[model samples]
Target: MKDTGRFFTVGLVAAWYSSNIGVLLLNKYLLSSYGFKYPVFLTMCHMTACSLLSYIAIAWMKMVPMQTIRSRVQFFKISALSLIFCASVVSGNISLKYLPVSFNQAIGATTPFFTAVFAYLMTFKREAWLTYISLIPVVTGVIIASGGEPSFQLFGFIMCVGATAARALKSVLQGILLSSEGEKLNSMNLLLYMAPVAVIFLLPAALVMEENVVGITIALARDDIKIVWYLIFNSALSYFVNLTNFLVTKHTSALTLQVLGNAKGAVAVVVSILIFRNPVSVTGMLGYSLTVIGVVLYSEAKKRSK
Candidate 1:
């Protein structure tokens, strides 16, 4: 039984890493290399895929008991979260078009700093002094990495930072809005609800912001059916990313998830640099290392405080 459990945990971790990294690389490929410059539309597709898959997993497969919004207030709360989710995902995708994955991952490593800031502002939650101090390296590391980055774009950097901040905001807001026992939903159920709402929010935005995107995508599909397959695979991987994330958290602990996430970002940076053949400077590597070390310190501080 112990061996089986160990294997299961390892498998979950592997899936989580693969799905997370795969979705990111695919997003980079589609948005940048493939010239599919329709981030809103692409994000909508991801939400649609997530919505359908989550419904199937929960309702049909009975992955977990079905959950429903009990009141209008709860529905609206979920809608707000979905809006933030849309912004985070779309901006991240847009950034990929202009930035290398290695630099983007380096920037993304600062999520904990933004999370801490949002948590304090929104909920007035306070952490230990050590916890607060640990963020210094996280912020400083990103600054160093940004300075050393060889292929930096101002717009892309701004979008990436915005995406990271929005992601942190969503995490903080989710805790605040869903604190009630009656309103709380499991991760899968939350995704099932939030994904559809995200699609609804993104549809009009995609249509208006990305002129003739649908036509262009269709043209691309007609020219080469492989693009369609790539999109379908990419969207499927997006759903898997969320699913595996939840599974890993459920089977392990949140701290373990955080640790794995930090390592995954590093692995992604190395893999992306190799795959994309992006130029890297020693200073940039030092900065990313500093940021990662800061994140590790932050995690340790949080664990000790708890």
Candidate 2:
């Protein structure tokens, strides 16, 4: 039984890594190289896919017990989370349109710094002094990386940073809004609800902001049928990314997830660079390395403090 459990966990971790990296690379391909410059609409597609898949998993397939919001307050809390999730995902897709995945991942590595800031401001949660100090390199590395990035765009950098901060904020807000035992939902259940709410919010925004994105996508499909297949595969991967992430967290500790996340970012950077042929300067590499090292240190500090 122990050996079987360990193997299952290893499989889940592998799936999590592959799906996470796959979704990111495909998002970059679709938005940047493939000329699908409709990030809001693309994000909407992702949410739509998640909504449908989560329903099938929980309702039809019985992956977990079906769950529903128990009160208006819980529904409102989920709505707030959905809004932040939309912002984070859309901004991230938009950033990929103008930035290399390597640079984007480097910017994303600073999520812990923002998470700490938001936690302190919103929840009055304070970490150990060592954990606070460890974030210095996380910020400094991004600044140094920005200076060295060869194809840096100001707008892309800003969007990427915004996405990172929004992600952190969502994490903090999730803790605050859903901390109550009665309100708490499992990750899959939370996603099942949040995905549909996100779609509800994203639909109008994409229609207004993206300006004929639907028509453009249809036209692209006519030109190459492969575009439709690419989108289907990409959207499916997005759902799997979330699913595997939840499974990994369920099976292992949050600290283990954090450590795997750090390694995943590094692996993603290398894979994206190789696949996209994005030029990386020595300074940029050094800065990214520094940021990753700082994150590892921060994780260690948190573990010791606990």
Candidate 3:
């Protein structure tokens, strides 16, 4: 049993990267080439899928052991996190529609900086000065990358930055909301609660912002079943991304998870460039490389401070 659990944990890490990259590319394909043109509706599908699959994992599979919010306050707190989650994903998808995945991933590398700033503001937590200084290269690299990006779009860049900030805020809020030992919910449990709430939050916006989702879905269904399959796969992978995030942190330390996140960002950028055949200037690549290196150093700084 111990060996099986270890193997599962390692596999979950792989699943995390696979799903993360897969969903990014799939969403790009769908929104760009496949002509989905409805980021909000697509996000709704993802949340619905996550909510259902997570429910099954808890109720039937008993994958992570069931957990429930004990009070209305806790429920509302989780719901607030759910709102942030929805905004992050919606903005990310919208950004992907306009920006190359490589650039998108490059911008995402600044998440740690945003996380640090939010943590200090929201939680009154302080880190070593070196930790803050390390972010200099992180911000500079992103600026260089943006300047050098051949396919940069102003709107896409703004949305991507928004997504990153929302993600950072979610991380800090999660820490505060779930800080108490008795109230802490495991990843799976949190997803189960959050995904459904996010769906509810997104539905009204999707309806208001998107055009004829039913008609578009039917058109795609008739024209190409492949698109529908991709949507399903994308949603399933989205849930796995959440699941593996929890599993990884359960089996390893937060620092290890952060390290993996850094690697994953680098891998996704390289893979996207290669797959999409996006033209990246030497300066841009160097900038992105510096950003990644800065992230690694920042992680190290945090570790040493701890």
Higher lDDT: candidate 1 or 2?
A: 2
Name the lDDT of candidate 2.
0.95
Query: Highest TM-score among the candidates is held by which one?
Result: 1
Best-fitting candidate, scored by lDDT: 2
lDDT tens per residue, model 2, 151-194: 79999999999999999999999999999999999988999999
Query: Using Cα atoms with residue i matched to residue i, what is each candidate's TM-score against the true structure?
Result: 0.99, 0.98, 0.95
TM-score of 3: 0.95
lDDT of 1 by residue, 194-213 (tens): 99999989999999999988
**273 Cα displacement, candidate 3 (Å):** 1.3
Prediction RMSDs, each to the true structure: 0.7, 0.9, 1.7
Ranking by lDDT: 2, 1, 3
List lDDT for all candidates, in order: 0.94, 0.95, 0.91
Predict model 1's lDDT versus the native.
0.94
- Once superposed on the true structure, which residue ranges of model 1 sit more than 4 Å away at CA? none
| Clashing pairs for predicted structure model 2, backbone only | none
- Which 10-residue window of candidate 1 scores lowest in summed lDDT? 249-258
Clashing pairs in 3: none
